[model samples]
Target chain A: MRTVEFETIAEAVADAAIDAGRVLPEDVLAALAAAHDRETAPIAKEILERVIENARIAREHQMPLCQDCGLAVCFVRIGSEVRVAGGGIADAINEGVRRGYERGYLRKSVLNDPLKRMNTDDNTPAVIHFDIVGADELTIGYMAKGGGCENMSRTAMLTPADGRDGVIEFVVKTVRKAGGNPCPPIIVGVGIGGTLERAALLAKRTLLRRLDEHNDDADLAALEAEILDRVNALGIGPQGMGGNTTALGVHVEAFPCHIASLPVAVNIECHSHRTRRIVL
Target chain B: MTDTHILTTPLTDEHVAELRAGDRVLLSGVVYTARDAAHRRMIECLERDEPLPIPIDGQVIYYVGPTPAPPGRVIGSAGPTTSYRMDPYTQRLLALGLKATIGKGRRSQQVVEAMKRHRAVYLAAIGGAAALIASSIKECKVLAYEDLGPEAVRRLVVENFPAIVANDIYGGSVYEETTECSD
Candidate 1:
């Protein structure tokens, strides 16, 4: 059994957060550039141009690509064979989040409560989701979810009679209703099946996948492509300015569910879509 | 475009009038920072007829809650938050003579109506581009609600701050006109 010091986790979390804060992940940037090329709406095209310019300015000046630095969320994949020593893993992760948010000049957006809405000041107590994946080598994925797109997310439980076409229609309508509110062209993550909460979790988790990749299931992958095509055909455009490139991509994830229910959740990601992963 | 207007911040009607939908601007002057919390407080203060924590007349309020600045820096990653969240309090500010606002996202119809009624303009800074905006800020000082943390009211001095006119005083909103499906 390998024992890792808590400080090691803390150090890794802090450094990773800082690095993620400074750079727009390569996949996100590439997706935006490609969107700019494919976008046909004049106004949407203009919005894309400004988005590209914003990235250039951010990188050149070493500034955050967008002002909403986002709430710190960490997904930890722990190895069952590895044990942590010196302190609690969760505490270490929080400490690292505090240190990195403060040091990197990323905004602390976490509020202590949903209704009262008090800023936590330090971006502490990161929203951490952990999974025990294997016997060796832990993987950590950190994502900063901004409020704009997060606010527009939706979940629904359709009867099994609704089928795949029903799911596609619901997703397209959700995107259309969201319009410019989520900061299009948006990346959509669709989670189907499982229990209601797990379906939402799967939707949020699917957001962590690479921008260009599709579902491993061939049928699901085709469904994802079809949904993407329909969403873009909405002509919501970049920044909802009106364009052919309404969606950057669609990703789907599925699991078996009770025969009575077909649950679906759509989590929209704004253009920035900041995320980073590290294996240690 | 070289014949640009160089206006001092806390923008006035004349400054706002000079701008049109889609016009590029390089604004320099003193702007104040506030977010959802501060906006709520400001509205509440007005309800009680209490003295405002910060003056609003002829002012350009930036919707931002910046990251803590590093040593010797004026501000950090100070970009606009989505503007619609503050929609409820906007008319109250406009009634008090607010001349301009800077943030991303489309404003509600009520906010747009208030902008026209009060002769105010809304500007859109690039969203998700905080670091780029910070480079334009030359000076920053806490003016009020320092305890509100990053949401505190800050008096900022900016130079060549880039923004596009999103809403003008003529009851026009670029977001509505530009969004193809809006019609």
Candidate 2:
């Protein structure tokens, strides 16, 4: 097995965190530009312009695009052929989060208690999700999820009879209910199948897919298109001020589940969908 | 562009009603900072008829929990947290003469009614724009709940603190008037 040093992982995580903080991913940028082109409302177009400008200024100045630096959430795909050296993986990740939040001047938003909430200062204790893969390469994906969009997410365990139409309706309803709160034009990530928790995870993972790409399943692709069209019809516009463009894209990822259960999860991503991937 | 309203530290119902949605102003004097935890405490104080740790009458509260400033700076990137989380306690606070609130997002129906009845206004600072928010704060000093960390209540001296009126005292809400995207 190839042994990778803890410091190496730490360094990569720290660097990736900083880079993710400064740069809004290219896909998000592209989506905003396209939305700007299609948006009819002059005010909505102006808002989109400012969003694009915010991303540009954030990149050029090496400052976070939004003040809510976001919770440090990492998805690591560990290789079976590789072993970690030095310290515990959790500690390394925490250290990396500390360094990244400090170095990048990202806001430290983690709080200790939900009820009697207290800020943790360093933005440590990243919500790390790991999967062991057969490949020799390790992949790390980071998404700086803001509170607005994160709060708007929803999940439901639908009856088997609900099926495809049910999933589409639920997702559209979630987005419609979210309205201007999630900061549109937004990205809707849908996860169908698996158990409840697995469905939620799949929904979040679907966010990592590129905006322009469609699901491999033709039926799913058609559903996504229909939902996207209907969502734009809402006229929530930019910042909910009124416009034709509500959602920038809709992405769906599915897995087979038990015969009785049809679980669905919707993860809403705001305009600043900050994410980046690294291989080590 | 600048209005000189001699409102008390924590503003009053009369003062709140004077403002409109989308008006920008420089807020001076005293205001407190509170988020989820502090909000609950303040409401609890009201529930028990106990005096609040700080005065709420005729004051404008900014709903923010800012990061600790780096050395010389008074405060770090200070932007508005989501406002709806405090919706539960809003009517109580407004009824007690808490004049205006500054935050982002829509409030509940009860809170809107409270604003109309008690004559309060909800102002919105741009969400997620922390650095820009920080630059507006001229001075800050912690007054209560030191252990709450960033969620502590503090006195802020702001010059031209930028905010747009969200819900006015007359029961006008940008959220109500603003068209929402459909799906």
Highest DockQ, which number? 1
The residue-by-residue lDDT of candidate 2 on A72-149, one tens digit each, is 778888888988899977788788888988887777888877775667888877888999888577888888788778
**Residue A192, candidate 2: C-alpha displacement in angstroms:** 0.8
How big is the positional error of residue B9 in model 1, measured in Å on the Cα after superposition? 3.5
Compose the digit string of candidate 1's lDDT tens values, residues B130-183. 776788899999888887888888989899988778788986666663342321
In candidate 2 chain A, where is summed lDDT lowest over 10 consecutive residues? A57-66
Regions more than 4 Å wrong, model 2 = A40-50, A113-118, B1-18, B22-31, B47-53, B177-183
Candidate 1 structure quality by residue, lDDT tens digits, A139-251: 77888788888887989999999999889988888888777777787889999999998898888888899987878889989998999989988866776556788788899
* Residue pairs that clash (backbone atoms under 3 angstroms), model 1: A63-B131, A64-B131, A65-B128, A65-B129, A66-B128, A66-B129, A184-A239, B9-B29
lDDT of each: 0.81, 0.78
Model 2 residue A6 lDDT?
A: 87
The total number of steric clashes, by the backbone 3 Å criterion, in model 2 comes to 10
**Residue B113, model 1, lDDT:** 88
The TM-score, computed over Cα atoms with residue i paired to residue i, of candidate 2 is: 0.88
Candidate 1: what is its chain A TM-score? 0.96
